[model samples]
Target chain A: MKLNLRVWRQQNTDAEGAMATYEVDGISPDMSFLEMLDTLNEDLILRGEEPVAFDHDCREGICGACSLVINGDAHGPERTTTCQLHMRSFRDGDTIDVEPWRASAFPVVKDLVVDRSAFDRIIQAGGYISAPTGSAPEAHATPVPKPDADSAFEHAECIGCGACVAACPNGSAMLFTSAKVNHLNVLPQGAPERETRVLDMVAAMDDEGFGGCTLTGECATACPKGIPLPSIAAMNREWLRATRKARR
Target chain B: MTLGPSVGLMALATRTERRTEPQPSMTRIFWRSTVGKKTVMALSGLIMLGYLVAHVMGNLKIFFGPGEFNAYGHWLRTMGAPVLHHSWALWIVRVGLLAAVIGHAVSAYQLSRRDIKARPTAYVHKRPRASYATRTMRWGGIILALFIVWHILDLTTGTVHVGGFEEGRPYQNVVDTFSTWYGNVIYIVAMLAVGLHVRHGFWSAAQTLGAGNARRDRALKAMANGLALVLTAGFVSVPVAVMTGVVS
Candidate 1:
């Protein structure tokens, strides 16, 4: 299949960027989207032009490194992350426009690559357990309710893709931060630092210059793993309780 | 009433303000920027939702008897956790609630404007599948704003004009006002709007904070919708029944 591509190109993090158009032919429908891009880059290299720069490690879609906003969506035309999307989703003569996540916090590194380290910083703030790792306790010692365990697993599924930040109008990362907070706060293992976790994560998220969540649900809609928005609500409730407790 | 040119100038001025590039002031960013403001709004809005549930339950005391209703109201007014009527307790509560309401409203306005600007063309997405409530958020918000103002004036300051109506008669005034057919109709419509708004708002708010996952998304949405329906229906039925002579 022949396709017209408008890919974002930039020399470095500080460089001004714009969409550069390219035409590619003979792409396989069975090829994954990233593979198709690989073919395009191969063609570019053959023609002595610079290959389109992008981020992808595990083409299996778990790492969430393959970030692109195809035709205005966070990943592509589909709800899944960019890696899982296939070329078959596009038509033979499709003109796909691809760009990096256009968020200030996640600045464009080169072309499709973005500095998602802000997410790392936010995570560092509160997305971990502070308990000592020396002793191993029995799994059933805590005996958490089945529902709480299930919810924790669901919240823990988030891969920290920055797609939510890109998809949101306000560019809020509340979904990302809240998911982490709720995941830890829900579990008995996470109970000791629950209050501090929410406070630190929330403060860090704001300090990182990411926007707050606006209840738009676009992040969830764009999320590849399908993280629910209710985690945010739970987090908010937890935060309120924590704040009240702290005040007293 | 004859001041037409002044009104025109005022309209033009407001339009220009809307059209002007959003000047990023410190206060503006805190209140209207995508992240912080929306987080504050979602958090406060959730708090208000809690208050609404409790308020609705309190309002249901009218069915128990006038003495019960009035006594309930009196208890709420008189009760203080620390037993200091002359202290700053009441003022602190009022300030806190006021701040929450203001934060929620300002964030909503900022978000509403952003939503308008984010999609220049209406329904740009090929699939237009937003719920009816989601679509009518602006309208519902406006109606709710009006309802809230009228509610404050009617109950708090006694601005709602009805002949021979006395002040501080929240229960009696409610019954009297709702006893009229037109009043019942208006109240029912507003309550329906509230219900719709709450349904979407609750779920969407959760999504904003990032707690929403696919497994619990439907459940949270249903729960929110159910809560909204129950509270709105219960409250609206009071006025509706009285208007229809069924409550007497």
Candidate 2:
């Protein structure tokens, strides 16, 4: 499949960026979106031109490293990560526009790559359970109810890909933070620090300058992991519970 | 301006020093946190929603004729008369509604500013996203606010009433306001805005308050839609009746 691409190009973090157009011919229908970009980069290299820069660690889609807003939808027109999106989703001669995540908290590092360290700081604020460090503990040591375990597992699917932020008109990180909070806060092992976990992580998220959630569901729609929109409501409950508890 | 080893040490020192400062009170913390501010928005929004339900119900009393409708208006001022002073209950409700409106608007304004700041850039390829109600929330809110000001002046204070204003006669006042073409236009437009705002706001508030979940999602959504439809129809009926000379 042949295609025209308008890709965002930035020399560095401090440099101004704009969409640069390129035409790629002789592309296979089976090639992944990343592969198509690879073809473009290879051609650019052969001509000694600077290639478009983007983030992608594992093409398998679990790493949450690939970040691209294609044709105004995060991760393109598909529900999966950019690496997993194949060329077959588009028709021949389609003009695709690709850009980096636009959140101020996730600043553009270079080209289509944005610094998502804000998510890291939010994780560092709490996303952990108190357990022994040296050895693995017995899985059955703490009896987690089936419902709670299921809920926790559901929220644990968040890959921190920042698509939620990219898709949110407000650029809110509520979904990402909520996923991390709910993943641990539901388990018996996470009981001890549940209140502080929510309180501190939320504080960290705010300090990082991310926007507040308006419940537009754009984040959930953009999420590759299918982290449900209700995850945010659950987190709100936990935060309110923690706040009331802390007041005493 | 130059990077030095001492700069790193100075940063570490300041970090440590900041930790030693007294912690803020819980109320301050709650107001400062994004999650907490959302809680405020949800609660205040619900308060306004409750008022809208009663307001629309009261508006429908016009169909009962001037004698009954005027009596109902009088009843509003006379409510809680024996237990409290005349108009005292009404004053209390007014104050409470005022507080809710201010809280809702202030948080919305601050959160919106932050949301805009978070996403500094826009995607070059723009596509229509989210439901119309969801997308128009901010603008719908502004319209409703302006309508509220005009509505109070036209009826409550009789300051903007198109015809000769009379005291203690809400039936004639309602007719007078709706008599003008511009009045009918503004009222109809604001009622539509109200429907759109409430359609998204109700369910969004549920999520913000953590009352929503997968099991309850459908029910909450239905309730939101039902409430929006009912309120809009009920409120719009007043102006429609006046325009048709059914209530004049």
Candidate 3:
């Protein structure tokens, strides 16, 4: 398949960026979106031109390292990560526009790459359990109810890909932070620090300058891991409970 | 290689060091946190929603004839007759509604500015995202605000009334306001905006307040739709009746 691409190009973090057009021919339907970019880069290299830059690792899609807003939708027209999106999803001669994630918290590093370290800082705030580090505990040592375990596992699927921020009109990180909070806060092992975990992580998220949630559901729609939108509501419940408890 | 004695001593010293600082007040923390701000938005929005429900019900009383409607309007002023002074209850309600409006607007404005700032750049390819109600929230809110100002001037203050406005006779004032073509146009347009706003706002508030979940999602959505429909239809019926000479 042949395709026309309008890819965002930035020289560096401080440089101005714009969409640069290119035409690629002889693309196969089986090629992943990243592979298609590879083909474009190979052609650019052969032509002695600077290639488009983007973030991608573990193309298998679990790493959450790949970030791209393809044709105005994060991860393109498909409901999956950019690396997992196939060329067959597009028709021949289609003009595709690619751009980096746009959020002040996730600044563009270069071209289609944005710094997502804000997510890391939020995680560091309190997205973990307070378990002792001496040795691994037996799996059955703490009995987790089936429902709680299921809920925890469901929230644990968040890959921190930042698509929620990219897709949110407000550029809010509520969905991402909520996923991390719920993943651990539901488990028996995470009970000791439940209140502080939510309180501190939410504070960290705000300090990072991300926007507030408007419940547009754009974040859930853009999420590759299928983190449900209700997870945010659950987090809100936890935060409110913690705040009331702290006050008392 | 082994660590030097000085390095080991330095690590121990740093580990033992603790920084002491006063914790921020809970109010300061709540206002600063995005989640807290959203909680405020939810509460304020619900307050306004409650007011709308009451306002629509009061408005529908016009169909019972001018005598009944005018009596209801007079009762509004003398609502707390024996205990509270005349118009005191009305003033209290006005003050409460004003507070809710201010809280809702302030948070929305601040959050919107942050949201816009967070996503400094726009995507090269623009496709519509989210539902129509979701997308129209900001603009719809602005429309409702302007309508409120106009509504107060036309009816309450008599400043913008089309015809001679009386102080207590709300039935005639309502008829006079709806008598004008521009009045009908503005009222209908704003009512539509109200519908769209409430359709998304109600459900969004539920999520923000953590009152929503998978089990209650369907019921919450239905309630939002029901409220939007009832309020819009009830409010718009006044003008429609006046236009058709059914109420006048």
Candidate 4:
């Protein structure tokens, strides 16, 4: 599929970005979105022009590294990641605009590359268990119900992609934070530090400069991992319960 | 900043204890988060939604004719009996509603500002993945604000009434206002916005308040949509009755 592309370009984090147009011809419908970008970059390098810069790794989609808003939709029109999106989704000669994630805390590094370290900081703040490493108990030592285990596993699928933050209108990380909160909080091992965990992680999320969740459901919709929207609600439950429990 | 699985247990323990060991200061930290702001929005929104339901029920009394409708309006002032005196209880309710409205509006505006702050630059291309009702919230709020002002003038304060603006005769004033084309237009338009706003707002409130979970999410959504329709129909029915010459 031959396509016209309008790609964002910026020299560095401090530089202003603009949409620069490019043409990619002789594209195969089976090529992945990242492959298509690679084709475009090869052409740019061949012509002695600066190639569009973007982030991508493990194009299989689990790495959550490839970040771009294609034709305005995060990860393109599908409910999958950009790397998982293929040229077959678009018509020949279609014009696609690619850009980096827009967030105050996520500064543009170059073209489509954005600094998503804010997510890492948020997770560091509270998204973990306080288990010691000397010896380990069997995984089934503490029996967990199917429902709780399922919920935890579902939330555990989050890849810290920053797509939730990018997709939210308020640029809120509630979805992302909630996924992590619920993931471990639901587990038996995660219960020991659950109260302190919620309190600290919420504070960290606030510090990261991500906007609040307004329940737009876009984050859930735009999520490549199909993270359910209610992970946020579950997080809210944990936060509230933790705060009240703190009074004791 | 990331609290990756590799982080030391000592660092995590110290951070957790320092945050939650001494005091309730963690409560303060909680409110500073985007989730905290959303919790505030949900709570204040629920307060207002409660008022809307009551207000609409009171409005439906109009169909019972002037005697019942006027009596209902008068009852609002004398609700608290001799202990509080006339209008005291009404004023208290007004104060509560006013506080909720302020909380909702101010939190909304501040959160929006934070959202914009989170995204310093515009995306080269954009597409909305949220519902229409979800997207219309900000503008819907503005319309409702203006409508509240106009509504008070036309009925409560009698400042911008059509024909005779009787002080005690709320029924007549209501009829007179709706008898005019502009009144119906303003009212119907505002009511429509109200429906859309409530549809998205209530579901969002439920999520933020942690009343929603995987199973409950569907029910909360259905309830929100149902409430919006009922409230809109309830409020608009008064004007429709007046315009059709059924109640006048």
Model 3: per-residue lDDT, tens digit, A1-248?
99999999998889988889999999999999999999999999999998888899999989999989998999988889999999999999999999999889998888898999999999998888767677778988889999999999999999999999999988899999999999999998888879888999999988898988889899999999999999999999999898887632
- Tell me the tens digit of each residue's lDDT in model 3 across B189-214: 99999999999999999998899899
Q: Per-residue lDDT of A63-133 in model 4, one digit per residue for the tens? A: 98988888777888888989999999999999998888888888888888999998888888878788776
Instruction: Please tell me how candidate 2 rates in CAPRI terms.
Output: medium
Runs in model 1 deviating more than 4 A are A11-16, A133-150, A246-248, B1-103, B107-132, B135-196, B202-248
lDDT of 4 by residue, B92-176 (tens): 9999999998988888998888887876766657565688998889999999998998888778888888698998898888888
Model 3 misplaced stretches (Cα beyond 4 Å): B1-19
Q: Compared with the true structure, what per-residue lDDT tens digits does model 1 show for residues A87-206?
A: 999998888888888666787789889898988998887788766567887777788999898888988888888888877765768788878888889998898778767766777776
What is the alpha-carbon interface RMSD for each candidate?
6.9, 1.3, 1.5, 2.0
lDDT of each: 0.75, 0.92, 0.91, 0.86
TM-scores for the candidates:
0.63, 0.95, 0.95, 0.92
Candidate 4 global CA lDDT score: 0.86
- Report the lDDT tens digits of candidate 2 across residue range A1-248: 88999999999889998999999998998999999999999999999999889899989999999989999999999999999999999999999999999999998999999999999999998899867577888888879999999989998999999999999998999999999999999998888889889999999999999999999999999999999999999999999999889632
| CA deviation > 4 Å runs, candidate 4 | B1-27
TM-score of 1: 0.63
lDDT of model 1 at position B56: 88
How many angstroms is residue B86 displaced in model 3 relative to the true structure, after the best TM-score fit?
Answer: 1.2
Cα error, residue B213 of model 1, in Å, equals 9.0
